[model samples]
Target: MTDQFLHDLLGRMTTDEKVAQLMQLATPFFKGASNSGEITGPMVNMNVTDETVENTGSVLGAWGAKEIKAIQERHLQENRLGIPLLMMADVIHGYRTIFPVPLAIGSSWDLELAEKSAQIAAKEAAVSGIHVTFAPMVDLVRDPRWGRVMESTGEDPYLNGAFARVQVEGFQGDDLKNNTDTLASCVKHFAAYGAAEGGRDYNTVNMSERDLREYYLPAYKAALEAGSEMVMTAFNTVDGIPATGNKTLMRDLLREEWGFDGVLISDWGAVKELIPHGVAANEKEAAEKAIKAGLDIEMMTTTYASHLKELIEEEKVDASLLDEAVLRVLELKQKLGLFENPYRGADEEREKEVIRCDEHRQTAQDLAAKSAVLLKNDNVLPLKKEQKIALIGPFAEGNDILGPWSFLGSTDDAITVKAGIEQKLNKEVIAAKGSDIETGEDDDLQKAIKLAGEAEVVVLALGEASEMSGEAGSRTNIQLPAPQLKLVEEIVKIGKPTVAVLFNGRPLDLHGVIDKTDAVLEAWFPGTEGGAAIADLLYGEVNPSGKLTMSFPDNVGQVPVYYNHFNTGRPKGAPDAQIRYVSQYLDSPNAPMFPFGYGLSYTTYAYDQFSLSRETLKKGETLTAQVNVSNTGKVAGEEIVQLYIQDKVGEIVRPLKELKGFEKIHLEPGETKTVQFTITEEQLRYHHADLSYTSDPGEFVVFVGPNSAEVEAQSFELE
Candidate 1:
């Protein structure tokens, strides 16, 4: 439908009905009939009876196919105008067949796989009648101590952008109306929720405009470009105002400038919490303020349902704004084909067939293998066939293998590391619990140590628990939790060679363990097939190609650190540099423990001299930036050849380097390949003070490397 048709429909809506369109409740995917209304979380009320399904909004709990259909039917048959309620649930990693968390997927750095994951998720969700998903959270997280980092794609803006695009495409699909399996992708947390102060979840995000525009906005912009249907406002405040009511962010940047035509929904109860943000007089005022700021939908907040119409009648809010907000929502529903067939996706059989099928499981396994980042390999990994190995850690054998937001997923279905190792090994393997995840007890540690001492090889299965790095799981200290590190130290004390297989959701501060362990595998929370994939890499069945998505800081003080830092005039001069003068720390170096894009492989690779097609290029012209990479080691491996560009001189001092493009490739032993990146003037463009995007004519530096830190640079001029 065109704007004219949408306007006519908007003009026909009653004030109460328009308010109803803006209100969304927490309804689960599964459908149910409740004689008595139910209260959930702090704010949701679901009134489901034999006759009518009436409530502020509904929350989808652990409902399966039959239940999902049954509940949606009630909403269609009973609600006023038979306008079906918006269905939602935490479809985090996977609905049926779980995959690794966002952190694990980030390690892969393969946006295609990320996109595929989203597509499958959309397929399953659409089949189940879920109209929207709270995902593609494009928050640029700098602090690893924030637990929700596990749910993000990592700390680099470029990689996050690539991943966000794939996810957006996956959720929304190419065509929303035709793809019944496609649900509207809700790009989340409007602005800067990840830079929570002190790496704590729900803390204030105080960042400069230069930093926010240059770094954080890129991912959200990429998501929008990928066709996201909605955006969920974050819970945290940017500078001073909470995201739910931040006009500059929601209106000036997102709507007016970016021209986003999607519905803006609040993060659960974020609108009412404006009172906590001290921005609103009460919940009613909060509702008025959020809607006025261009927020189109109130998720689980009855404020819009109960207070918006009153605010309009009292002359506290404009009717046009409310109409515009409702129109956006109606436009989305119309685009989703909900207006034509409200029950188009309410098929029970299709939902069952799509959920947890073999195709989804296979994809999960492939992603699990791809997401495993090899941090260190000291010529001891890819263990020999007859080797006696000992696997140790609380996570080594448990079912709590899936990471956070894994709602209704079966832990019992998970394939443990021990099981995988045992199945693959011809010889006997001993496995023991090293220590409790949160606590550092000795009984388990002693047993683990004993097994390590006897075995020729020790595979220490370690890292944070499933809950340690997602949502409310933030921690100030990111070190390997206690006695587990001590257990590693004890096992290291022995003469036997050891490899550490870590399962974590965030970048951990492993200062002491870095050099001690012979090989370190950052396994992340690889889903049900995690064990099989780890074993495959352990025995050289698969080479480790994954790289670190987030920069691993050496210590807690350098919380917000990355590889693309600007050099100050007062540079740190080696270790002898005075700490008072530069960005250097008193106790540590200015570098991260593990830089962004840092990862190791069993096979060696060499970066040859970079060759450019032309050193000087005119406007609208292209430059072919090429580099020859050779696999020098015995076994075949894959490498992510990264290309970065630096603006040598600009009106504003640009970043030292920015990732331009990258390619992931597989090469056999001694195989050489010349990889090329097509660079255009668009690559040099930056957001100006006026928010206009344009490239300045100047000299540029192109750097090609295995990772951000180890790069070879060349210069060019753009006239």
Candidate 2:
């Protein structure tokens, strides 16, 4: 439908019908309307009537071709205007053929793979009748204690913004209405949801406006610029106002300033949550505040459904706001082609044919391999197949490799590590569950010891269970579980060659595992084909090239440690320096266990001959930094050459270094490549003390190397 047609449709809708368009409910409400409906679960007290349920404009958490087709057909038949109900779900990583979690995908530093994974998810989800996916969650997260950190890319505004754009392009493609295999992308948690205080889920977020704009808002802005059709409000409060009702944030910044005219939906029950956040008195007040704040949809709540019509009638809320919100909803439906065909892209045969197909699985396998980070190595990797091997740990035979938010992926289809290893070697391979993931009393430690004694080498598969990481999965202690550590200690006492393969979601403190293992691979929740990918890396079929997106702390007490932190007045000196009164920990080093952008490959590379095109840069000039990287080792490998910039002096203190650009290159033995980065004046701009974004004339330092901590530096002046 065109704009005129959508306007006409809105003109024809009644106040009740228009209000219903702004309300979204789950499948339970629809299933509980008649004699056949049981009215089970949480919807019992929602007081949702049959008319309200039938008039709802969207349905979430309901999929499958047959189920969606029936729901849409029924909704359209009952809806007086015949406006179709939009089907949306949380298709985070994959629909069936799961890929690595978002954090792991960030580690790959492969934008193409990240985009391809979203593309596959879109295709699979589209065929299953899902028109929208609440994905590509572009929140920049520095705190791993926020369980949802697994949902976001790591903590860099530039990196997260870059990935956000690609993910949006992959999901919506060029033309959303014409693309049958694509689903509309919704970039979520609109303003600083990831910066929850205490690193707790849904905790209050109190940050300066400068911090919000400098670090939190870029990725969401980038996604909208990439043409995302929807934006979801955050669950936390910005300053003292809940994001669901913060007019300054939702209206002034998002709508007026950013010009985002797309549908703005509240997170699940967030609009109603304003009452609990102490901003609203009741459902009517919550409904009024949300609509006035420019929220178009109240997801999974009856606040709008219960009180919006009365609020409009009493003139507590303007009727035009209702029409505008309804217009955005109809506009989205029109763009999704729901106006033409209620069951858009819902095909049972296509769903069966495309779900977890070989091509999709191959892409998952490829991404899984690229997402594995090599944290430590001592010539113990690339295990020889002829040597007797022992694969011991809870994860060796377990198939729970798919991380959280993989709602549709079945564990039955997941490939176990034992299965992947057996396909490679014909020799004796002893596999044992050394201990349970969190319990040491499985009585399998003795058997694991015997297997290790018989084998020439041991591959210890360890890490947190899949349940330990995603949403509501925060951990106060970010180290390996005591039982798993005990298993590692006993196995390492045997003194055989050991390789530790970790499957986790968040960055972990790996001091214990690193001390005992000869090689450590952080295979963070690699999806469906994760086991196969791990086996491939171990056997040299694939080289480890993934980098750390989030920094690993030395201990849990060093929470919120990131590489791009601002320098304090008293900075810590080198470990050898016995300096007092410095900002150093009494018992621990000031540095992270593993720095950001840190990873190891099977072979080594050397960086040399760093040069700059100019010693001074003008306001509008671009400077080029060049570095020569050579494969100095005996084997072929890939390297992520990183470029970082630092402002020598600023009105406000700046981070020690900020990642500006990076290039991943592959080289053969003895091959040398020249990596060049073009830095412009725009890259130097930052939010000043008064919140004005500008750059200062001063000296700047440029660093280029493999990771943030180890780099070669040069100086230049900005005029």
Candidate 3:
């Protein structure tokens, strides 16, 4: 049946019946539908019961194969037109085989691997009958102060674009109709949500047209170009207009200019927020504005479903806009093959067979180990077999490995640090709670010290839970919550060789740990098999090669910092009489605790040299930039060969450096390998003021290294 069958059925229905299709209600994720207006309050309560999917208009963030299938079955069987509601979930990293966050994966600089992870997520999500995912958040994030930087691929347009294409392929695959397990990837917060004012969530985004076109639009374009079936408008505004209802943004840029023939879904309740932004008088007016602006779906907002039909019939809004919106929605269902095979994705056996399998666990472990950026390390790491280690912290024994938006994962099965260490060690290992997470009590500190006294080394496991740093989970001061810092400081006074293993979703201030601990490993809320992976790296089973995707600032005030920043005339370097007038801060060093692409390995590696195939090349000529990386350590390890490019004299001023390519290579002790990266004219262009992309004749520098901080530079010229 084409949408004509559904459309004709809808046509025969009463006004209330058509309105029901537009209405989207938020029900309890575990239960069904509810009359709850807003569930997220200060208490952080969740109202769940045994309710059917038909009571609510649509399901929001519901996972688990059994629950998801039941909801779908109910929607199809119970609804008046037998219309199946769209199932949405936040499959941010991985559905079951959890990979590192977008930022960490981006640090791998391996877009192929990133895409593969998404493919796995899509396969698992589709098994559960999920229609779409609010993912591949292609926000060009430059400010690390924003906790959600962990979710973005970092702050470069060209780099983000390349990664976006890979993610789209992973999510949508080649054929959506044939591949029901694959769902639509929603490239989110449509535009300029990353450049939030003051690094606050949902803050106003004020930027010039040139800035928006040049820096922010490329990744979203890349996703659409790669055949992303749908788009989710962002939560913030652009130039005083809310992105959910901005005609210039949604109509002009997304639909008309880009020729996107997909449905535009609004961020959660974003349509209803137009009133708060003073853009509309009420939800009714907001619906009128959003529908005209090209928003087809109103996620979690009742504005569209409740009022849009009334507005259309009364001539308050054109019925053609409604028709156009429904057409786009129907067309998407046709593309999904949902009309012909609505139950194609709802296979019970596939759901049980595919999710959280051994392959998924192994992949998760590999990604977790690879994402572990060795911030600071001494010989204390890769602990010897003879050593008796003390693992102490709130997170060590707890199975909280699943990060934010991981609704599908069960923490009950997550690997604990204690379990991981015991499996690898025959030596006596002492474990203690040490203290509470944020408030290290004096008695708890004494207990940690006592445990440290009995062990040869102390491995302090600390950091936030998965839910502490995601959306609406932002903190004012992103530091190691509470007494974990105090506990570590007291234990370090015992003078035992100490290593801090941090499990966090976002970067945290580790100044105290840096000052005290001999070694530190940022094991970002490594999902599910995190403990097993951490133990491998700790016991020398695997060498740490992961690099920092986001910078770790010394303090909250020193945030919005990154490695590829441009040089200012009065930067912190110059000796000045009055420092007050400069950009330098008085209280803290104007630098991050760890720079972007900053990581250390168990073994030492040296950069031999950088060489280019050609000094000058024609417009269409391909250039090869090569470098020799030698492992100069006793143990074998992996090295991430980073390649950065800079156009010295372009039509516009460029950043000091832009990451062009990277290769993660495995090398045995004393091994050397030559790595090469190819460059084209496309790699040498920037968006001009007139919104045109063109490459200029100029000198381009190719900097290669393990991370951004350390690199060997070579130059090439385009003729």
Per-residue lDDT tens digits of candidate 3, residues 1-719? 66677577546655544444444545453233332334665213323222322433446676666666666665677666565566778888888767766776776666666777888889899888777888888898866556677788777776788888999899989988887869788888799898998778888899988788877898999999999888888889998899999999999888899899887888877888999999999989999999889888777666766687789789998877766666566566667776667655877788889888888788777777787888887778889878888889988787776777666677886788888888777444568878766656677677778888999989999888766766766677787766887787788889899999987767777777888999998888777788888899998898888777667788878767767666665666567635576768888887788876788988999887688898987777898988888999999988888888878877777777887777888899999999989989888887776768888887888888776767778887888
Per-residue C-alpha lDDT of model 2 across residues 245-277, encoded as one tens digit per residue: 999999999999999999999999898899989
Give the better candidate number (1 or 3) by TM-score: 1
TM-score-best of 2 and 3:
2
Residue 606 in model 3: shift from native, Å? Answer: 2.2
User: Best-fitting candidate, measured by lDDT?
Assistant: 2
Model 2 CA deviation exceeding 4 Å by range: 31-39, 426-428, 574-578
Clash pairs, candidate 3, are 22-305, 23-305, 189-234, 190-234, 438-481, 438-482, 438-483, 439-483, 440-483
Backbone collisions counted per model: 14, 0, 9
**lDDT for model 3:** 0.78
Q: How close to the true structure is residue 319 of candidate 2, measured as C-alpha lDDT?
A: 89
Worst ten in a row by lDDT for model 3: 42-51
- What C-alpha lDDT, on a 0 to 100 scale, does residue 522 get in candidate 2? 94
Clashing pairs in 2: none
